[model samples]
Target: YILRGWIEDRSADEARGLDRAGWATALTDPAVGTALEAVHDEPGRAWTVEELGARGGLSRSAFARRFTALVGMPPLTYLTWWRMTSAGRLLLSGDAPLSAVAQQVGYVSEFAFAKAFKREYGIAPGRYRRVENARAAS
Candidate 1:
């Protein structure tokens, strides 16, 4: 229930932002919102368009089109971005091993996780963590 409140709060914030663009009512759209919630609630899951579309009660192609139009990326692309960001937060804030962090963010291999992390953040996860730790200490 606490997580659901946070999600609702974020949607309200997004709606406020959208008000400036004349689309505030889009916050009421269940399809895109449901798909987003599924992704955010389970970033560690192996998410696919078909699965997400099913969650939204949308056809695969329709969900892809609508999600991209509303969320600014295809479902899978957003999933990767979300996973990377979630992993980056873990790297910054915790002492968890890189392998464990990878698993938490749905990567099975540390090497793949490192590669993706570097691709997204422009630095390896270990180095990024060290830098963040240093910053926190200072």
Candidate 2:
């Protein structure tokens, strides 16, 4: 419930409001569970180092180093992974056309979305959609 609330608020484009969500609550304190919760809450939005550092109350370089140590990857990489994961799930679940799905996930165009999706999943969106539909039929 808390996580879902955070997601909804973040997707509303209120990033500052989301800074206090369940996922972001443990960022500086570095709880693995809450760090992941933050990822779960806002999977599709981009995050900058300075922004997150300020939220965590640290310098940019310090946040970068500490986040790397705790999260094992930089914030941008983690954001991309999170974005792709959200896109993949939306692709699999929605009957909306790829373009619609692309827009839903913050891509400006279908071609770009398809390309990113393919790069992330090793298959084109149409092919993956077809496979997903076929599986659901059975």
Candidate 3:
């Protein structure tokens, strides 16, 4: 009941364009929706474009085209974006170690995770977490 209400509220927020993630639009297509749900459900999984295409009952090329058309980005692009986004949230909200956060987001290597995170966010994860923590404390 509570979860249902929260989902409804989020749906309403998305409908009003208040959701910044912009994922709701992709849910309108059944095939794309299936793939999107899988990604959201398991962002930490090492997902391949071919595997995601199979989940949607599509061929790789067709799925990539359709996913890009609907999501405004390729599948792996969204995956990386999602992984980084999740990492950012973990950084802000928890005291988890960087390596733990990295693993949680599917990066096996802390160095690689930091590199990717810096590329996406323009700041190191440790620094980002400190900055966010300070901001919240203020």
Candidate 4:
């Protein structure tokens, strides 16, 4: 719904040559795109730079350099960003427990996930879920 609308809007902007940066631009490269797609499609996978580089058919150093150059961030950084983004969406859209959300985003431990989520979002995951749900209700 909202996510689809946002994607369509971004696609429309790109179609009009708005020159936006980030994943849309980074995905134009074949090698980087392959690696990025893998990360996006299976964000819960325990990924390593070596594995991602292999998916891109490049040496680890080469893939890292190209991904960083095009994406404006390191690959793992983007992975974390995507994971947190996914978790946030799940939190907003459902009544899943925090542990489930944590596992879905690749965190095996609720404590660790909460710490990472808090670091990224500046609020703990449970509180974030509650606040966002309350705001949506209002």
- Each model's backbone clash number: 0, 1, 0, 0
Candidate 2 per-residue lDDT over residues 1-138, each given as its tens digit: 444644554653342233343336344364334445565676544556776677656777887776666655676665665666677677777788888778766677889888988987789988998888889899
List runs of model 1 lying over 4 Å from the truth. 1-28
Q: Which window of 10 residues has the lowest lDDT sum in candidate 4?
A: 1-10
Better of 1 and 4 by lDDT: 4
Q: Pick the candidate with the highest TM-score.
A: 4
lDDT of each: 0.76, 0.65, 0.82, 0.81
What is the overall TM-score of model 3 with all chains considered together? 0.83
Which runs of model 4 end up more than 4 angstroms from their true locations? 1-19
TM-score of each: 0.80, 0.66, 0.83, 0.85
Q: Rank the candidates by lDDT, best first.
A: 3, 4, 1, 2
- For model 2 the local lDDT of residue 66 reads 68
lDDT of 1 by residue, 6-117 (tens): 3544564465342222222223468877877777778899988998888879999998887777765677976887788788778877899999999998999999999999
lDDT winner between candidates 1 and 3: 3
Runs off by more than 4 Å, candidate 3? 1-23
User: What tens-digit string does per-residue lDDT give for candidate 4 at 72-92?
Assistant: 678898788778877888898
Clashing residue pairs in candidate 3 are: none
* Model 1 deviation from the true structure expressed as Cα RMSD, one decimal place: 5.0
